[model samples]
Target: MEAVQFSPPLGYVFDPTDCELVGFYLCNKIANKPVPGIDYSIPQYDLYGSEEPWQIWNFFKQRLGEERDDQDLYFFTQLKKKTSKGSRIDCSVGTGTWQGEDGGREIVNDNMRVGTKKRFRYENKDSDQHGGWIMHEYSLDQHSDYVVCRIRKSEPALKKNKRGKCQEVDSEKKKKRSKVQEVDSEPLPLAVPPATSRTAPTTTMVQQQIQLEDETRGF
Candidate 1:
């Protein structure tokens, strides 16, 4: 018989170092919230480090078309660490310039502490553009072992519709109005009177009185 060769293991073990960062931008409304900041940092590692940075940057440049000095983009990342029991994770945010090498530059910041939140401001080097800081507040118990990051372009002030003033529509009013209209449109049925409305027939006392008068006349 031939001796059989044995293999130690078939698959690779999980490595913390092998893990990659991923991130996304929060919606304009929620961008200031804590979750977005934590979530936005992950993609930076995946986007910038996974592939050649320059190649990705070149591709981004072509897609973007024109480049400007005043624009900014933000993202977040989650850091995974190996532990005896399991993996531990933390969240962070990456924000900075966009366009050239300097444009790709980013700043990674710690996420808001549980029960406490913070906001960041962006300053434009150029004075001609309208630049302002965004405010973010962290929700309670929002932090976790996993991190979530969000990115968004600075938005202009929102304009309200000029045609109508905001008014709340109530279902109760609609229902009541419909009931009133139905009552007004339809005619009511005739009502019948009760038997009590007529006078009681001549009482038994009157009949007795007539019989007594006849008896007295015969006498």
Candidate 2:
């Protein structure tokens, strides 16, 4: 199967929310059911390799046009179980490691907590200058086998900066949150969208029920 590029291809926009990632796509992958664009949208990879972030971005990024996802790159990565146990994420990838920020938070799908998506910052020995890059790691509550990471270069607001810069970032964040909430609260549909399009999340029972429905729908 041809893999989906990280960036949107011609005549299409690939914009998915936290809810859709955890509720729909991640759920299907955990259940071993077929995700329509799994092979393309999110290819399997262990991103903790030696390759630099930009280098990795180039590998999965869209080469069709000037359009690109400089801030976020999606990949289906397996969670490495430590011999010590207890969900200890093996963070070492190359010369840097991704450090989790602000503990994990729950993401609800149709009023039910489907999973927790955590935010992590990249860091290295030389300097903590890697703050420009961020990783949003999503893993189902029950299924911890594999995760989908939305890696992007996000520069935090500087303390010395004025209110304008903060406002801009806040606006973008508000729009993102609004979009995610809007998509998650909607009801499930019988028909699925096309592969080129990034589908939205729908209201459902628990993840298992949603999984069954997805299987029946062949989405």
Candidate 3:
């Protein structure tokens, strides 16, 4: 069968929870059943090959552009045996390796155990130092050879708190602008006409004075 290629719309993110990854995507995939949008959302790739994590990140970054800088990536990769008959798997990628952070954890769905998930950190093979790249590996309890992986860069807590503060500041500025706009939109009070001159003669009075002056001239 031909493998399905996934090409998401701009700004689209593939972020499935652990239960969804195992109970839904993985189960249907291993059973040869058709998953509605999996063919377009998640693609099979050689994640353990020579490509580093950043290279994978850059590929999506360039394809999706900066608009998707926060997007998470997912892939379907099969485990590789280290020997002809051994249980060990080779997880080396390029010049770095994925080191497990803790023991595997169980993923439950609908009050039943569905799968297991494990966290791994990418470390430089030479220095053995970890980076910001983190991955969550998910696998079915019934099937372990094939698994789904979610990878993303870890964000610093300080940066997240700073962003929250910035958002609050922006919200306050918007509120002030809205109030100014409302004031500008309101109609100004009708300008009161300057008090009419009290000494000015009325039109009827002026006409009477002209008549009296004509009568006096005639006499």
Point to the candidate with the largest lDDT.
3
Evaluate all candidate structures by whole-model CA lDDT and list the values in order. 0.33, 0.71, 0.77
- In model 1, where do residues sit more than 4 Å from their true spots? 1-73, 79-172, 183-191, 196-204
RMSD of each: 23.1, 36.6, 17.3
The regions of model 3 sitting more than 4 angstroms off are: 1-6, 64-66, 125-129, 155-219
RMSD of 1: 23.1
Decide which is better by lDDT, 1 or 3: 3
What is candidate 3's CA lDDT for residue 19?
85
Poorest 10 consecutive residues by lDDT, candidate 2: 155-164
Please give, for residues 54-137, the per-residue lDDT of candidate 1 as tens digits. 333334334333153133222233334455477542121123222211211122334422332333333333421112323222
Model 2 lDDT tens row, 1-219: 234454444565446899999888888887889976566566777877777665566566644243444535677888775556576768766578888897889998789998998888777645433554678899988887778998776545222233555687899999999999999999998897666535866545797687888899985
Order by TM-score, highest first: 3, 2, 1
Runs off by more than 4 Å, candidate 2: 1-9, 62-66, 69-71, 84-87, 127-129, 155-219
* Cα error of candidate 2 at position 185, Å: 76
Model 3 worst lDDT run, 10 consecutive residues:
1-10
Best candidate according to TM-score: 3
